[model samples]
Structures are given as C-alpha cells and as structure tokens.
Target: MKLSDFKEGALGGVPIALGYLSVSFAYGIMAAGGGIDPLSAVLISMTNLTSAGQLAGTQLIIDGATYFQIAVTTLVINLRYMLMSLSLSQRIDPKMSTGERLLVSYGITDEIFAVAYQREKAPNTPYMLGLISLPYVGWTLGTLLGATAGNILPERLCSALGIAIYGMFVAIVIPQCRKSHPCLVVVAVAAALSCLLKYVPVLSSVPTGWAIIICTVAASVLGAVLYPEEVDEV
Candidate 1:
C-alpha cells in the first residue's frame, strides 16, 4: 500500500488503460445507437467493467428483452470472471482483509487479471487499486465520448473501432501461444470449438454467451488435465 507501489502499478496500467479506451469506445457507440443515453452507457462501464457482458446486455435491451434475459446473458458471458478471481486468490496475499478482497474483486477485468498474474509477485492493495484505476476511468470516459458522438461518427468508423477490442485479446494471447505448448493447444482448441459451435448446424442454435462459456471451460479443463504441472505463464 505504499505510495511507490501504487505509483508503479499506475504506471504499469497505462498500456491497459490505453487499450480499454478503444474497446469501450465501441461499446459506447453500440449502446447509444441502440437507444441508451450517453450517461447510462458511461455508468454501465463504471459499474460493470466488462466489455463482453456489457455488449451482450445492451443488445438484449435493444431487443426488448426481459430483465431476466439480460441478467442471464451477462452472467453467462461473464462467468469466466468467477474462475479468474478464484485463480487470482492463490496469488494475492492471504492476509488481505475481506473488504480489500471485495474491492479487488470489483476491479478484476480480463486484462487487469492477466497483467496482475504476470507480475513476479502478488500486488498489494494500493498497487492493485492503482492498477485498476486508470483503466476504469479510461473505460468510462471512452464510453462517455463514444455515446455522445455516436450519431456524429460515420458507421464505418464505428465498426472499425469495434474490431480494436479483438486486437487487444490477440496481443495478450499471441506471446503466450508462442512461448508455451499448453497455451497454444488450449487456444487452438478453444478457437476450434468456437468455430464449430458457430458453424455446425446442430450447435449453431446455442447462445453466443453460452457457447463462449462452454468453449472456455472445455479448453481450460483439457489444458489442466494434459499439463497439470505447467503453471500459467500469462
């Protein structure tokens, strides 16, 4: 919780914040275009900090879905965060208080979790707080700007910016895939399953969020069974 640790974490988080801006920008556009107000879109980013979940939820809302549908869709899409939090628990200080753990849990986005896991040692409270701070702000601010400007921006530009989010995941995964056989195999299997679920007539009826959850669990279990000794590298 030292000032130095917090500053170091904030510095480390700069790249993450920059990356989030692009993705959240796209989310904002989607939300506003779908009829949500700019302020509500910003609030969604502030509260959720989940790109996929927010996107899915907004789409459901646009479709005039029931509250239950929105909840289930988001829960399905974000179910991986529960697993990430469980895995991160092993690395965080066991003595960290319950309140601090709750705070940390609130900030556990995919990129933040990956960055924290890559650290040589578990980060302390202030460090973890600082790590999540700017990205949170960037996500919210991007949503604000995008929502307010969605109508002004060309549809082509908005669509292009939407692809930026996928690029961030690629950046996170490519190095690990290259360095570790397990990572490569897991990613390949997940990709294959995703394609199969989308293209195979029998499975194509599955909801996108549910398909993602299934693919993730299947890939993760396979990796764990095949390489029980290999610690995650990224």
Candidate 2:
C-alpha cells in the first residue's frame, strides 16, 4: 500500500495504457459501426478488457447470434486468459488476500502479465492496483471516443482506422518474432492456418471464432513440440 509502490506500478503501466487506447479505439469504431451505442461499447471495454473477445462478440451481436453462440465464442477466444491468470497467480505477492487477488485478476491482460512477470519478485497488491488502474481508464475512454467518433466520422476515415487493431497486433509480435526463430515459426504457422481456414471449402464454413481458436491452438502446439526448450537450464 506504499505510495511509492503505487507510483511505480502506475509508471510501468503507461505504455500499456497507451497501447490499449489505440487498440480499443479501433474496437469502439467497429462496435459503433455494428450498431452498438457508445455507452454499451465503453461498458464492454470496461468489463471484458479483451480485444479479441470483445471484437468477436460485437460481430456476433451484429449477426444476431444466439446467446449460446456468443458465450461459447467468447469463451473459446478468451481461454488463454485462464492460463494467464494461473501464471500470474504464482507471481502475485503471497500475502495478498483472496479478495485482492480476485481484483488483480481482472486486470491480467497479456501485456500486463508480461510486465508483471518480468519483475524480480512477486508484485504486491498496491503495485498491481496502480498498474491496472490507468490502463482500465484508458481503454474505457478510448472506446468512448471511438464510438462517438464512429457515429460522426466520414465513412472512408472510419474504414481506414479499422486496420489499427491489426497494426497494433503486428507491432506487438513482430519484434519478438524477429528475435526468436520459434516465435517466427509460430506466427507463420498461425497465419497459414488462418488463411487455410478462410479459403478451404469446408473449413470456410466454420465460424471465425472457431477458426481463430483452431489456428492458435494448433500453431502453439506445433511450436512447443518443435522447440522444446531446456527449462532447468534457463
């Protein structure tokens, strides 16, 4: 609960907050274009804190998909968060209470997890709270701005900004891929599988959410099998 710890956490989260703002802005545009109101879109960002899940869910809503479909699709797309949460649990200060841990879990996005996990020791509750706060606010505000802008912005401009989310993803992964052969392989395999799923006759009929799940799992397993690292040595 130290002020210094909280300040450090907030400072560490600034980059992540900036990234979330750009990405969530794109999500807001997409949501608004699909007929979601600004408030609803902002609320979705506040509650979900997931890019893929929110985007897929918004698309499903536009398509008039059943509740069951929305639930399953979101669950499939967000299954990685389960593993992230488990990993983060091991990195949280053991003195944190159950309630505090649950609160911290809400902020455990991929970027946050990466930063928190790299710390020399487990992150205490105050640090985690500070880290999550700014990003959460940024994401919610970005969605609000995007949604409001989507309603008034020119069609061409909105269309152009639609690519922002993908661009962000590329920005995140390309550096790591360049540094690691295994990472590159995984990305390539996932891209190829995604393309195949989009083009192949039978597979093309599968929902986009399922396609993503299959591609991610298949490529990840392939990468793990191909590059079994020496864990103890590391």
Candidate 3:
C-alpha cells in the first residue's frame, strides 16, 4: 500500500466518483419511491457497487418479484464483471495472491475497469483500493441524499439525472468504437440485438437477463467471425 500508488489511484477515480454521484442519486430516489427506506437503499449501493444491477433489482423488489427472479436478473446483468475481472487478471501482477485478487475484484466496475486498463503500470492492491474508495463513498452518499431528499426534486429533473449512467456508458464506448473496427462492429451487433429483444414480439417475451446474455455472446461471436484476425490481435 504505497502512498504514491494509492494517491495516483484515488486521483484516477475522481471522474468516476463524480459520475457515480448522479447515477446513485437517481437510484436512491427510485428506491425511495419504490418503498425501500433510505438505510436499505444506501445499503444496497454500498454492498453492490453497481448501477444497472441495483436499478433492476430495486425495480424487481418494487414489483414484488420472487427472490429467484431478483437473483437471476441481477446475476445476468452483472455476469460481465466476471469477464472484466478476467481481462484485468492479464494486466495485473501475476503474483497477486488469491485474497488480494478477491479484494481487488470487489472494485471491478465498468468505469473502474476502463481507468485501470489504461494505466501504464500493473495495478496493485493498494492502488485498486484507492481507486475504488471514493467512488464507493460517492455512491453511498448519493443514495443517502436521494433517499432522504429526492422527493423535493422535480420529476423532470430526477428523470434527467437518471440518465447520467447511460451517458457515462456512452462516454466509455464511443472512443473504443472509433479506435477499432471490430469493437465498433461488436457494439453495433449488441445494440441491434438488444433493440430487437426489446421490440420484437417473439423476442420480447424473453427475460431481460437472458436477452442481455444472448446479445453479449452473439455480438462477440459475430464480430470474431467477421474479423478473426482483428479479434486475435486484441
């Protein structure tokens, strides 16, 4: 836990923290509106550290979805984190022990992964901790505020804040699409599949989790088939 490493990681996390504040705030408001108390909403943010998963899970809870449905929905949405962690394993110090890997793995969100992957050095435990710390705090704080005070905010404003997470995602993906044709194609395929699943009558019946999983796998496969060499280069 070198001070320098931690500091650098914390600095890298600032933007992510800022982005999380708005998104989590939106989550908090939604949770509060859905009958989850402030403490419970904050607890969910603290423990989960994910945007989409929490939002979906909260909605399910509000809808009185069965436990199995909630678990499967959240799991399906978050399965990508496993793949992200695996990709990170390649860039991290190979000597990292199981415990350190587990701890570091807790912080492996899409935004955090993007920042860490860009680092020139192999990210260490301390660095990863520092990177995740602020975002975690921001998430919790935002949820607290939203759960407690969000009702005072107008509906239109709340709606606007809720889209911050999506904007963050677009920010992450657009640059990659510009850099690589394969990446662009894969993203396109995934988006198209998602739209089809959401809109087409037959596919619309499929569960959200399964639809997302299908899109992710199918898009990657099609991209690889179309650009085997490019995929291999990555």
Best of the candidates, lDDT: 3
Question: What lDDT would candidate 2 get against the real structure?
Answer: 0.86
Error of 3 at 43 (Å): 1.8
Window of ten residues with lowest summed lDDT in model 1: 225-234
**Stretches of candidate 3 exceeding 4 Å from the true structure:** 201-203, 232-234
lDDT of each model, Cα atoms only? 0.84, 0.86, 0.86
Best by TM-score: 2
Higher lDDT: candidate 2 or 3? 3
Better of 2 and 3 by TM-score: 2
1-234, model 3: which lDDT tens digit per residue? 699999999999999898788888888888998999999999999999998888888888887877887888788778879778888999997888999998889888988998998899999888898999999998999999999888899988877876776776788789989999889989998999999999999999977656766888899889878888884322
Which residue runs of candidate 2 sit more than 4 Å off their true CA positions? Answer: 230-234
Instruction: Give RMSD (Å) of candidate 2 vs. truth.
Output: 2.5
lDDT tens readout by residue for model 2, 1-234 = 699878888998999999889889889999988899999999899999988788888888888877887898888878878887887877788899999987889998878888887877689988888888889988998999999977688888888989998887788789978878888999999999999999999989987767777888899889889897822111
